[model samples]
Target: MPDFLIVHTVLVTGAEGQLGRQVIRKSADQEVEVVGLSRLDLDITDLAAVRKRIAEPVTVINCAAYTAVDRAETDADAAYSINETGAANLARACAEVGARLIHVSTDYVFSGTSERPYEPDDPTGPKTVYGASKLAGERAIAELAPTSTIVRTAWVYTGVGTDFVATMRRLEAERDVVRVVTDQVGSPTYAADLADGLLELAELAEAPLILHATNDGATSWYEFARAIFAEIGADPDRVQPTTSAEFVRPAPRPAYSVLSSRAWGAVGLTPLRGWREALHASLAG
Candidate 1:
């Protein structure tokens, strides 16, 4: 609740997702109004519904995305519906109502072959349908709502549902040994931490059109899984390191996905805590 940033009513488009729910919970103590609508309540793919629902001047955080990576390879249409067209609908609606649009995107926008963290303005070349669709959404928003904010994050999980953290926790309880991908590297972002950051971004009046926000550091999936095992009182060695080639999927995962938070800090926003510390907090909670 800073004096510089003024917020009244903020609308969330994907309330049922873990990130959306976390943002709503975090907003309780902040000096802003956050209203959420799940897909059941308002499907963003429906332009008529988008216009009908969003008529006031408010800050809108879009969290709805087609996230099924492997499935998206075969279901590109479905992916485009939610990721690209749906985002376009919201952009048009926000522009018409003079509302601020803060769209949540993915680091998958990049090909993941870079040696360092991807900057906000880095050239993008997505490797999967899911990634391509999200990138398309980013472009659509840029064209429709030129001033809208697009924040790209990576490897986000809430230690629930089917996210990587949740899967690791379940495997630790069910099996003796688990093999995680070491060749693939990225920032493991806890959804709660990201939720807090988004709420902070919603309050800021002046921010870059595109920004990258994730945990401070980066690690491979195998290392991240080992860390998760250690946090939950399990043996870290039980998790074995492997490469992406050993475990191929229908859609290729980015070999590297660390997103740079330098842009986020340059804007005078609070830097998110480091990944290991944030992971401990998430498991402890």
Candidate 2:
């Protein structure tokens, strides 16, 4: 390693999660020392637990979240406790310990009515309980840790996790056709790619307080499903396109979840590859 390479200790919350697992795996060859903590190991909702577990001089990567979109509608309190309050707890703990915080957020923070992609400073109008709670967490971290970095991504999928790519692959094996919503659009991000981006941000001397990091380009759910099928050597025609109204869920999805990466480029970091390339690499791996 170079003399300038500061090998900081990194504490990863939600270590068992898709993105967190990737972060841990990628850090194996890097200069950083990583300590992964699952929900069982550290209950971030408990402030004392956060402070006790995160007392070391480290960079904290908060991948823990209540990610069940539809379930959050009925379980609003549970979602808030984890997503909002838990985030605040981690922020406060990091501040006390003088650790840098990198909080992972979602594109759901926007209402998705904009014709273009959303900027980091765009006005937020979340449409669901999950989105609202995540936005609240972002606010809490911003207020508590002024130097913390908040990375908002969208349509994240991983090979091992129960994400869109895995779901489509499973459905392709099980059923003749898989119906996907055509109206909902966003950038699809592979977990490994996202992990790399976060680690890059961690090494920066100074980064934007808020940044958007996702695989480049945009596509609707229907298109994304078709690409996934094509990558797996399955019949793309079997994946059918339907509007959001046909399959109504408890949570309202944004019609457009695409986020702009201009801020990401402005900071002098190379943007991630396009969604199609990332999807192929993830499935192949």
Candidate 3:
């Protein structure tokens, strides 16, 4: 808590999600009043409901997003409705109530063609429906809630449940060789770590309008899988590296989505530990 100026109640949307759950858990240790709402509880697309729920001044962290990348190709309406319209509703509500809005975004907003890490002000050319919708949402929030913060993250997993890290663990037990793509590279952000970082942002009185956050460092999917296998006492050698062309999907995954920590550090904000160290700690439990 450290006597940060955040004295208002904190409301989190998408309470059942990986990030939302971690935010709730992290909030328990901090001196803050938090109320978490799931999809069933608060449909952000319903503007009337949003206005009713957020009638007072409070800090709102929005984790609600339609994140099915492949499905988003055919379900553009649903993706935009949730990711864009829903986010706009929250931003509008926050502005009316004088609440601080912190919305979670994805790195898919980029075209994935850059060699270096993505900066917040980098040119954006989303290549998929999902990315387009998220980018739209980011823009809507910026226009509606001028003082809000939009944080774009990549390759997030909690190491438990149905996330990529958990799937890797399941595959390690089910098969000897797990083939993963080598061309796709991004930051691997542990949900718990991301949650801690967001809470830290909440404590600040002011912050950049848009910023990037993730566990430090980057790696390809193949290397990340091998690291996971090694962490769980499995044979890392059994993991095979493949290419994106071999396994096509409805959505064109970004080949490079690593986000830069330069803006994050420049704001005097705390950075999450390196990816490997966080991965080791995630599997330790």
Candidate 4:
């Protein structure tokens, strides 16, 4: 790694988010200094605020995003403001201060029609406002900060947040049975694992401009729910599998949003552990 890649300070935006919190926690043992800023401290949509906050030569990991998938259908403007314009603001600020950016993205950029895992350079056909806004963010960062690394991950969950694992655990306690969508398939990435992968990329002198980082294997939401129940010593039999048609939401979900990890592997970093193993670790923590 080049001397420049030897990070001195890391500025993490969206510091209160699931992945952002993990990044902060994981970086404690590292030699570099880390500063985490929540939306209350720094709004990425405000260019002046972003510029003022990122005035130093530090690595900027943008975990901030408008993540309301279903609400984005009715609130496209709000989503675009944060996901697209906010990303552009950060990119521009990083370029001015000579800070490398690691922008977190989503797998929703793809249509999910591919039989195989989606690659970094695959054509994007976002099916929802949320997906389109996220894709716009990726484009803005790429165009404004050419040296930035864009990491696209999917099905991310953390123990602390209102994620899939938490939701399933709550429903299991309240209901007799839980119905999960079986038609949709994707890799479940623990926020902690994803955070570690982003930091690993931060340490590299050279990495792919675009990479897919997630847990090794893929599974449907139904399988994931069952695994979650098994992890908590609950009745896995209480988890029921159902198709997407049974419970429709405003935003269209991709049927297959699994992303390939070949790009991350090519950069000499191992992919994350399988979803089941990560889930167990997350629950145990």
Candidate 5:
């Protein structure tokens, strides 16, 4: 709790992404200075480049990733380069600089077979290349830089970025009925809330070994879409709940990968709100 708050520099990768940009906006209330970068500024897969970027002692929050779930089947090398290799590079550099590394990850690391929420210590059995790659990144960080905080979130959305919420909003304007997979269940995390949680964790003197940073309650994509429709004052009946088999993609998604924030709570961090409540706030914004 020392005054490390005085003009501390924060380096956020994938600044143009939904989560990164939210971190930028939310950090306005803090005393720390924030510098954000997209792939153009730093391709994290390059170890030398990452080392150079970490020359200054600053908090590094890596939000960069190849998130094309379906495309990952055909382009796994590219995904691994960005997700796995890039994470390794960043973790090594953070260790060199003694900086806290906050790496954003996904719930896809699990096989989605759990009846309850996955804990931080839960064994990861990824079903797709994208999931496997992200899980690899988590493992790399844990083995290489145990001081780093690996945040595994799920179904993230923001008003400005390309996410399910934005897609649903756009589709609602054109289609009378929209079908979403109901069997695949996870929490719909608001990027802004996740950003806040990261900043809080970053400023802390000690970061957790691992944490689940999603919104509290869980729901399938179908129920999530229905909630979105209702929040926007659209007809909930227009949102149809379907199974995953009907909407098959190139990558196999998890049937259920909701993550629990028990690890984060162990360190006394405030948990995020429930999905519906957070979604309402995002839509309003």
Candidate 6:
């Protein structure tokens, strides 16, 4: 890290996550000192552990969340443990240290009924427990520490984890055909792009910054899967488009979770690439 460049310590939770890992790797080039902690190293749900960790003055990036949308319906308690209480703990800790917290939220915070993209200040009406918990997390973070940022993103995918893109790739390799829900519309965000946005937020000396960061364009899972197939040189026809009713899950997904980047721009930060461009880049990797 450079001495004159105002080097700061970054304490990143969920270090093994796709976005968290990307943040750690990319910070190297930017010369930012990072303290990446996995669940084993530090679990946010444990208040004692979190309080101890945040005693140091460091920029905190929380990427941890119970993200299994379907499972959350049956396991709301588990979801709330990490997403609600855990978030509050981290926020309070950040407040104690007088550090800026960059918390990653989700589009599920919205009901997804709007024809237009969701703004940062829009009213939240979560339809599922996962959504509700994530929204709680956002609120907790904001209320506990006014100097925190809540970044809502959607349709996230990366080389790691079992995301939509990876699932599509797996199905393409095995099945002759695949069924995807077309009713849900949202932008697919590359973890790498999101990581960059976090870095930008860390550099800013602002408080209570709520931003929506994702790939620019919107698409349904059907379209997203077809694009993934096209990139992988697989048969796009094999990926069949189905309605949400036909592909029922335990949790209810928002029909449209598209988020606007207007708030991110307010801070003079450019939005991420469009879904098409990001999809191509992730597939290439």
- The Cα error of candidate 5 at residue 27, in Å, is 0.7
Instruction: Quote model 2's TM-score.
Output: 0.96
Q: What is the TM-score of each candidate against the true structure?
A: 0.97, 0.96, 0.97, 0.96, 0.96, 0.96
lDDT of all predictions, in order shown?
Answer: 0.91, 0.92, 0.94, 0.92, 0.90, 0.89
The positional error of residue 5 in candidate 5, measured at the CA in angstroms, is 6.9
Tens digits of lDDT, candidate 5, 1-285: 786546889999988888889999999998889999888899899899889989867999999999999999999999999999999999999998887799999999988999999998888899999999999999899988899989999988895546899888988999999999889889989999999999998888886778899999899889999988999999989998788898888898898979998888778889999888999999998
Model 1, position 31, has a per-residue lDDT of 89
Worst 10 residues of 2 by lDDT: 1-10
lDDT for each residue of candidate 2 in 1-285, tens digit (9 for 90 to 100): 677865688889999888889999988888888889998989889999899987865899999999999999999999999999999999998889888899999999999998899999999999999999999999999999878999999988886658888889889999999999999989999989999988888888668789999999999999999999999999899999899999999998999999999999899878999999999999888
Residue 130 accuracy (lDDT) in model 3: 99
lDDT of 6 by residue, 129-221 (tens): 999999988889878997899999998889455888888888888899999988999999999888988888888878445889998989999
lDDT of 3 by residue, 1-285 (tens): 577675568899998999999999999989889899999999999999999999998999999999999999999999999999999999999999899999999999999999999999999999999999999999999899989999999999988888889999999999979999999999999999999988989988889989999999999999999999999999999999899999899999999999998898898889989999999998987
Q: Which stretch of 10 consecutive residues in model 5 shows the poorest summed lDDT?
A: 154-163
Instruction: Specify the highest-lDDT model's number.
Output: 3
Model 4, 176-276: lDDT tens digits are 99999999999999999999888888888767779999999999999999999999999899999899999899998999989999989988887899999
lDDT (Cα, 0-100) at 259 in candidate 1: 91
What global local distance difference test value does model 2 have? 0.92
